[model samples]
Target: MTQDAPRRPGRRQAMALGAGLLTAGALPARAIPAADVQPPRYALERGARLRVLRPAKFIDPDEAIFNENTKRFTDRTGIEVRVDYVNWPDMPVQVAVAYNTGQGADVVIGFGADPHLYADKVADMTDLAEYLGAKYGGWFDLAQVYGKKFRTNQWLGLPMGGTTSPVVYRRSWVKEAGFDRIPNDLGQFLELCRGLKRIGRPCGFALSHAPGDAPAYANWLLWSHGASLTDEEGKVTLDTPQTARALDYARAMQETMVAGTMSWNGASNNRAFVAGEIGLTQNGVSIYYSAKTSSDPAQNAVAADTEHAEMPYGAATKAPETALTLNAMVPRYTRVPNAAKEYLRFMMEAEQYDRWLTGCLGYWSQPLKSYAESAVWSSDPKLAVYKDAMDTPFYEGYRGPISAAAGAVLENWVVVDMFARVATGQQRPADSMREAQRAAQRWYRG
Candidate 1:
């Protein structure tokens, strides 16, 4: 039931942490068709300067295009911007601190359900979100689900994009194991893992407290098995037969995983897969990207063998959810709200966003439906698997509204722990389900 104590400062103060910053300078603006782009008018404050915080890039082009676009925004407008890139896992903590202290970035690109957790502390982005959605085809259903405040049209955040956490596997190894592709059936998937294990190249999914990896699989495991932490009414309903089946399934899968996966973090699987340690793992395109772009010949060899497939489905009979979205919010504590909004507006416009989308190489799927046509998806057939990530079910608060309670449950890693306990044999399926029920109820009933 605990939340970050809101120490809302009355006046804005300069943040002293200056490392890992890309300061925007006056640079030449790239030409875009004036008729194609018409942004809303915003009267920026005098000497308006913005500080933005976003996740560090998994590949060079994502950062390069973003920095170039930021410069273009600065070039188009006279406002100065300072962008800070932090590790992905650190985004939630940093954003929490920023809102609490009112001394970090004015505009933050945070993780899933973050805007819900700090809704009151952020500016209403409904105008901006609506404008962009109208201009583009429209935001995806999942984007709207994560962007808007609970039971209201007010937008607490703008959906930036989501990473497609597909199953990254070795093509040769899987074929050698006698499976042409990763199976959609839960039992078949487990058998595939066992086959991979027998060949000494076992699969691994983060079972530890990894911010991205743990939840990606754990949430998928829950939804794929027709279980959820809460029902549509936001009631804690983790203790169920469906949930027990999932826990038991996870326990069986974990038995076939690589040793020490119980202690692995977000980056562990990527490193392991690239090193030929694991035959299969769930991750974004970062692993394949790094391998293909690496200077080492051995890593490049691994890249040739890399392939991707969407996560399998179980009792849900559909693609399971993944925790991969990144959201943008302008904290109300900012002195220059208009300038902050303008910056996001400028960045999202197609002239800039198209390049950024193409530059990301399919690691990030578009929130807007129109961006689905970006060349990144078609540039390589291997990347096509990630093209519709945002269209899939997302937000760990499935079957219920994404509230602060859901955010708290995710932040506490309750779901990850519940699955990990069963997977590691620390608790039986029933015991883990009961423990998770008690833990989730404390938040839902708070």
Candidate 2:
């Protein structure tokens, strides 16, 4: 559908695809509490219309959840909401073009590390954020960092919820490898890959220039090894001994991974897994759902064996894969601040938010701390593993601000390419580190 741009997640839907754009469509500073924050004093503007662009409802069977939500929102407040869907890959360029041309949606679904890039182009929603946090709960560290003005702490977007990523794999294969559950320790996880490889079923990891998969893999690997892209002081620390060690781990990982992983995109690993080409890989739950919905019973059987686990932790474990932290922002050029603000506020209420989350299936996990204990997770075995990962996720540019520089580094896939060089034997682990260090330094220096 995204003939224009099918970007990798979100990893936009954490199901990476690239082809086109359909008008489609974050946690915030915080969520919940219709009573906690006083709705702004201004009356809802009658006939106020809004256009919101986002990725398609990948988690839902269709966009009906949003269509219904839109209908209800308009019904409750006379505002006409025009929604469009865009393919994830095309979103960054299209959204930027919209902003640059002063022609854009009143409200938009921005990805994990986007607010900083559009901070000035979008309106500050400090009041709305404060109200939500006060009424619902305090903002998580990742939410606070990604949603606010990095230097000013001024609200630039409403903390909408985001997608949670997981290592979706075959349960039986893992069991056969002498593990009762998915590996929770890094060492065992790699050994599991070795075991799988020996049995003619290797694991797959994206080593390509995937906007979604690349960063997700890099950050997860780096963080687990107790390393980071940058330090808290915002310096590029990718060249450290710790980072070199992470690279070494990746190179070793390649031995057990399919060689073609160096060229895989967001969907490559999923395709491989469902096709029975690979036994393990990281992805959102969509992969499992994909198998569950297949018309083929064999595929359904694949779904039966399919399961998920959060990435195994490491000495440096602090966050999960860069889960899609979907946030909503209003462009500065919007004509209806009040409407946009109210639209955002309406979404945070428990009834609407919870329902929307359900409609999205388990693809979305809540960012609000209070929702952490929700039965949505308790209700199913497949979904329960995600709750902790969602609660503990760190934003893409961990130990650093989500800024233009960091965004540039990610969009360019410097980290992935760096790891690829080592995995593909294009460079030594140390040389790959030096190369990525130079690339990151150029961006940080700017």
Candidate 3:
């Protein structure tokens, strides 16, 4: 079956992949309103159709839950929902074309931080916030960056699921290398990597893609080193000496990463790590689900042997902050704004939230702090390791407007290419960062 094929069977198989069953006890306690509670006026009518577009690869369980819940929504309210899965590479262009032409699905997913750049094309979600606040008991805190909310407040997008970048490694390999545990400090981490390499087992660090994975790693390293990409005034200030140190360390790590990663995109890097060819890599935890379930057993070799931890920290900074990422929005063009708001509210409830997370097979973080802190995460031995990592997670500025300038910086291929050049030794880290900083300043100024 194709990757996007109906995953009912796969869901069942995945349920059986581990011993932890979806227990009734796992459900949250809050009571949803009775049927008599007046439904939103814009709720879909019986057989009404809604169009959705999202990336193809990440479709698995989230799509399944979304379709199933949507069917239930239709059944309860008499509306039909239709969804279309697009390849990740095609989604941005498709969204761009559709938005420019005034034609596109009612909902789209997988843009990541790019929506800030496409704000004009996508609907502003701010108008729906009051409705969401009333329904979902206030909006997500992380959704509002720097006092302005992106989708509704600033009116850009809404969150579907929350996620963070984490360090994934093979526990067994680390144990064999004489390291008792994953390193928390930068010095220890580098020592661990060198030790692993000296034994002919090179460690893997993700530095792939121009803006996607590479920048994510670079940002993480910057944080790890106690540096900020932008200060309170929203200026481009990544050229500081501290940031320079972080970039220098990243370049060194890039040199030791598994061969060919410079050409690898996000998925390729994950595949190489899962295949046991690399010792460690920084990436989203979603790869854990994919690695475990891949048809080729070798592709999942590290699944059973691996463990997760918070992203490593710098010697100077004990803990670094990262973004609480999500995909969400209230479209300005939505015909049924109230209905969309209602759906967004429902999506965040504990019951629906559980279904979405499980259905996605644990690709992203649970948005509710209660869910992450509860037994749902801790009781599962495999996932418990991640709980500590979530406690101190970081996000972009909560008070500032989503930086259209920063978003553009991320989209520039030239900037990414320059970073790659430094990583591969084609240029010095300072020179490459200076070139990229100049480009970012130009974008910010323009």
Candidate 4:
């Protein structure tokens, strides 16, 4: 176990750590398919070898199926491919080093706005993107948002699917709290938490600087209240009345949480929920997956009681926001760009992609629409909520374009810090908003 990134998302500032350059939608029931578009063909380079860097497999089966698929690709093309799985936090660092040095992995799979951060340094993927989108019934809106370079509309990355943070909870506990279902209204949602708290089983949302869970909670709180970090022009516009209101709401909601959530990391809530210490929390489907596949009787019982739901809107009633979007890109320095791109395409083909998706056990939501018909979604009723992750509003930068600066804001944990301060009683709503505003301006204005 080499400290694999456990679907723990977001991250600390990569530019500072690596010392490098740093840097919607929905609808339509049936996925749009290209009836006549043919997938692009590529000539494999003789004796070509490729190394792909991606976040370590969070689930064991994901690794198994992926490796098996890689072998299939190698067997078919006679090109060797080496897939290196690393921690999520290391992804940006490695990506930065690769782009800076013009060596290392030929292709890299990274999370959240990474493509845009190195858009200029990566190979042009427009043709590949178009081919995949056409053959696979089209990429979801959020996928397109992350896959293409904003100003030029050039494809910077291949849209790989991502892990989604949904509301994972105990069905029995929710019913005990007097709610057969999670409410879409924030006010009613708060009351449900209050009831859970009164029963000595409080809801627990991460308030720490966790890479994934903390930002998931923070962004949902802010966006659901109509608060945004920047305008469409990318100007810092964080200090707003709506943001203050979101902070206040967080303060109120804090009362219904477990006492130590302010210090919880990405894995904390999962541990607490399975241990029967917390009644509710936002998380990937990993907890349920673990419990379902575990040998322990108590864990199995926990799995039986588990369920997943989408996060509710606050006053804004906007579409829910997601925690991470994964992408794959080829650096311009790769000696075998064709081999790298071909590897990506081969893995994304329906046959391999479908198998990989099924093996993931619903932990990953597909970026392309055709996979919506995958059995993984219908295999377990609880998994249905995650299948629509691509339909949620694109959240990495929010009202602004996804830029290196926005990545800096996220890596800096500005939003997470703001919400945590209010929830922990360390600062008032207005003070936290002001602090967040100043923090975001430092990056956006630079």
Q: Relative to the true structure, how large is the alpha-carbon lDDT of every model?
A: 0.80, 0.71, 0.58, 0.79
The ten-residue window of minimal lDDT in model 3 covers 1-10
Instruction: For residues 130-207, write the lDDT of model 3, one tens digit per residue.
Output: 444454444445544422434344646765554555667788777777798878878788878877776656777545
User: Largest lDDT belongs to which candidate?
Assistant: 1
> Candidate 1 on 1-446: residue-level lDDT in tens?
00112222111101100111122121123222234545678899899999999887766666767888899999999888999988766777898899999777889998879999998899999999988987777888778888998788899999888886789999999988879999998889989999999999899998798768888889888888888888888988789998898888898898899899888867788878988899999988778777776667898799899999988888775578563787999999999999999999999887777767765666667898877766566557988888888886556788889989999999899999999998888888898889999999999889
Q: How does candidate 1 fare on TM-score?
A: 0.91
- What's the alpha carbon RMSD for model 3? 4.3
lDDT winner between 3 and 4, please give it: 4
Ranking by lDDT: 1, 4, 2, 3
Span of ten consecutive residues with least summed lDDT in model 1: 11-20
The candidate 4 region of ten consecutive residues with least summed lDDT is 16-25
Return the lDDT, model 2, position 224.
86
* Model 3 vs. true fold: TM: 0.83
Q: Model 3 Cα displacement at 442 (Å)?
A: 1.9
Off by over 4 Å in 2: 1-37, 42-46, 317-320
1 or 4, which is superior by lDDT? 1
